[model samples]
Target: MERAKPSSIKRATALRYMGASGWQPDDATTALLDRAEEKILAAATPRAAVRRLPRAVFPPPELDCGTDLTRHLQGCDAVLLMAATLGSQVDSLLRRLELTDIAMAAAADALSSVLLEQICDELEAEWRAKFAAEHLYLTGRYAPGYGDCPLELNDELCLAVDTVRGCGLAITPQHLLAPRKSTTAILGIADHPVTGTLAGCTTCHLRETCSFRKQGTTCFAK
Candidate 1:
C-alpha cells in the first residue's frame, strides 16, 4: 500500500534515507524520479493481501529463514516492494556495457543499488504516517541469490503481491526487474516488535548454508 509523504519532514528525512553515506540526488534525475513517484502515487492500486511471513531473511530457505529471522520479522505488517529495475542506471553507461540492451542492464544495476533503498525508505515512512503508527519497520529485504531461496521465488512473491498488474513492476529471466524504476519485496506483519538495526544473512551463523553470504558482504550488517 502507498503512503502519504510527510512534507514537514522531507528534507531531513531525505538525508536519513541517504544514511551515513548521504544519497545525493542529481537535479535532472531527481526531477524524473519525483515525477515518476507522483504518477505512481496518483494511480489507484488494489489493497495487497498482507500476510506475516512465517519467516523473513535475505536468503529464504526451503522453509523460510530460521528462528532468528522469524523473530526479527515478527512485527512487520506489510512488505514494501521498492520497485527496482536497474535498466536506467546501466543505460547511462551503455558505452561500457557488453551485454544485450547493455544500457538497460547498466541502468538497472545502478538503480537497484542506489535508488531502490531510498524509494523504499520514503515509501516506508509514508506508509507509517498513513497508519498513524510506526510498527511498519522494514524487516530487511530478502532478494533472490541469498540463501536456498530460489532466484525463481522472486516471481512467486511478485505474483502474490499482484506486482505487475498493481504497480507495473516486472522481473526478467535474469532476475532483473522492469520499469528500470520499480522494485518488489515481501513485508510480513509483526504484532510484536523488533529493536535495533536490520541484520543481514551473513550475521547469522547459518550463513554457511546461505547462498548470498558466500558471495561476500553480509546482507544484515557489516
Candidate 2:
C-alpha cells in the first residue's frame, strides 16, 4: 500500500493517550505538545503494507486468536492484514528527548501514538473507498493483543504483509513492534454491513484497569 497524507492528530486524542482526562492544558502544556508534534512530524516517515486473504486460510491454524476475534470475523469471507510504522527516526527522536527532557519525551511519545493511529485510520478510509466500488463492506480494524488475540500473532502478521521488506517494520523478541510506534491489524471484508466490530472497552483486555475507562472515557473516544 502507498502512503497517504495523514489527517491532523487532535490534541484531545493525544491527551487521552497520555492518560489525561477531564483536564484542560495550560499555555505551557500546549506549547510542549506543539514542540512534540513538530519533532515527531519531522521524524515520521509513515509506511504500510497490506495482504488480503480468504477467511478460511487466515490465522494459519497454529495461531489461535481466541473467540472474541472469531466472533468479530463471523460473517466475513475475507480478511485484510495490515502493518504500519512511523519509521526508526521517530524512535530515535523519542529516545534522545527522554535523555534531555522527560516531559517533552512523554508528550512526544503520546503524540507519536496518536500519529500512528491516524495513519492507520487513513489507510482504512482508503481501503473502505476501494472496497466500496466492489460492493464489499469492512469490519473495523482489529489488532493483535486486543481481547483474546495473542500478541505472538504480531510475528505472523508482519510476515503475511511482508512488512519488513515493504516498510522496514519489525517485531522485537517480546512480540512488540520495534519502532515502538508501529501497528499491525486485520479487517474483515463482508458482503453485508458489519457492526460491533470496532475495538472498544468491552473487548479490551485492559478494560478493567484502563485509566481512560476509569476517567469515563475510552482510548477510541473521538
Candidate 3:
C-alpha cells in the first residue's frame, strides 16, 4: 500500500462538484467553502494500492466491461489496477455535519470529491514518471462506470488490488465505494504512447442525465 500526503483541493474543481461553476460565490458562500476545505483536509488520510497484471488477467473471466474499455486497452501488454481512498475520517466528518449543518456538509462533500481526484492525479503523475523510466507509456486512467464499462467491475478491481486490506477501501452491497470518496481504476501499460482516448462527458455513462449537463456545464468545466 502507498500512502499519499494530503493536498489542497482545487477550488474550481470543488465548485464544479457543487454545481457552482461560472457562478461567483458571495462572501458567505466563499467563507463556507473555505471552512469546508479546512475541515476536509484535516479529516482526510489519502492512501492507495496498485497491482500490475497481464492484460489477459484483466476484466476477469466472467465479466465483460464493454467495448469502450476493450478498445482502450487494445494493444496494451499489461494493466495497472488501482484503488484509492480519502479514508473513513472524512466520511465521519460528513455524517456529523449532515446532522447539524446541511450546507456545510454539502460543501465538504464536494471538496472531498475534488481532494480524492487530486490524490489520484498525484499518483498518476508518479506512475507516469516511473513508467517513463522503463521506456513505457500509460493510457489514461479508466474507471469502471466511466463509459460502457460496467460499474460492477469495481468488485473485481478491488479484489485485484487487495483494496480492503491495503487501504481499507471496500465496495458496499449497493456497489458504491465505501468511505464515499474512494475509487478504483485501470490504466493500460503500452510500449507506445496511447492516443485518441475519449474522455469527459462524451464518454461518461451519466451523460444523458448528468446534472452538470442539464445545467449547461460539465463536470470537467473549469
Candidate 4:
C-alpha cells in the first residue's frame, strides 16, 4: 500500500528536460525508461513545508547576509522559508541503480532532478494562490547557493524553518542537503506585483561549468 503520493514530474521545454536529465534516449534506451520512471515514482515520498517570517526578524539585521537578504527581500513584508524532499527511499533506489545498472541510474537521476523542482514549483504555486487572494504577490524564490548566497546559509535556513522536524530534511556539516534530492529557498511576499525572476545562468557563480547551461538548458525556466 502507498503511504504517500509520488512527486510529479515537470517536463522541460524544447528538449531541455532531456538535457537536464543528461540523456537523449534512442529506441534502445527508450524501452527501459518506463520501468525506471516507475521505480522512481514508487520510491519517492514527496514532502514540503513553509514558514512565514518577517524578513528583518528572521535574518536579524546584524547577520552578514542581512544586507544581501534585505536586497533580495526588497519590496516585501515577509519571507516564506521553504524546504522540500523526495525522501530517503529514492536515495536507496539511486544507490542500487548505480551499482547494478548505470544506465537506469542516469535516467533515474535526471528524473529525480526534475521531480524535486516540480515539487518546489507546486508548493510555490499553492503559496501564490493563497497570497493572491489577499491581493499580495510572491517574488521569485531565491535559494542558498545561488549567486552571492552561500550554501552555508542552508544551516540557518534549516534551523529557522525546522526543516528536519517539519519536513524530514537535513544538511550536513559541509552544507550538502540530505535525501540527496531536496531543496530550500526563500520567497518574498509583497503588496505590489512581484515577478519571481530567478538570477538565471548569467549571474550564477557556476555558469561556466554548469552542465545544463552548457547544453542550453536552465533549471530556472518555468
- Structure candidate 2, residue pairs in collision: none
Worst 10 residues of 1 by lDDT: 43-52
Best-performing candidate as measured by lDDT: 3
Off by over 4 Å in 2: 1-7, 196-204, 207-209
Q: Compose the digit string of candidate 3's lDDT tens values, residues 1-222.
A: 656666567897778777777678899999999999999999998899999999888988568787788888888989988899989999999999999999999999999988888889889889989999999988878888887888899988998888999999999886789988898889999898884254667667899899988998766555
* TM per prediction: 0.47, 0.92, 0.92, 0.86
> lDDT at 76 for candidate 4?
86
Taking all chains together, the TM-score of candidate 4 against the true structure is: 0.86
Summarize candidate 4's per-residue lDDT along 1-222 as a digit string, tens digits. 112454445433323555635446567666666667788888898888789998667655554652444566778888899898989999999999999999888778878877777778778888899999989888877888886667878888889888888888999989879989888889888999876555656556698888777766676654
**Order of all candidates by lDDT, from best down to worst?**
3, 2, 4, 1
Return the candidate ranking by TM-score, descending. 3, 2, 4, 1
Alpha-carbon deviation at 166 in model 1, angstroms: 2.8
Pairs in clash, predicted candidate 3: none
Off by over 4 Å in 4: 1-8, 11-24, 66-71
The number of clashing residue pairs in each candidate reads: 30, 0, 0, 1
lDDT of candidate 2 over 130-206, digit per residue (tens): 99999999988888999878898888889888888988999889899978889998899998998535555666779
In model 1, the runs with Cα more than 4 Å from the true position are: 1-71, 75-112, 134-138, 179-182, 195-222
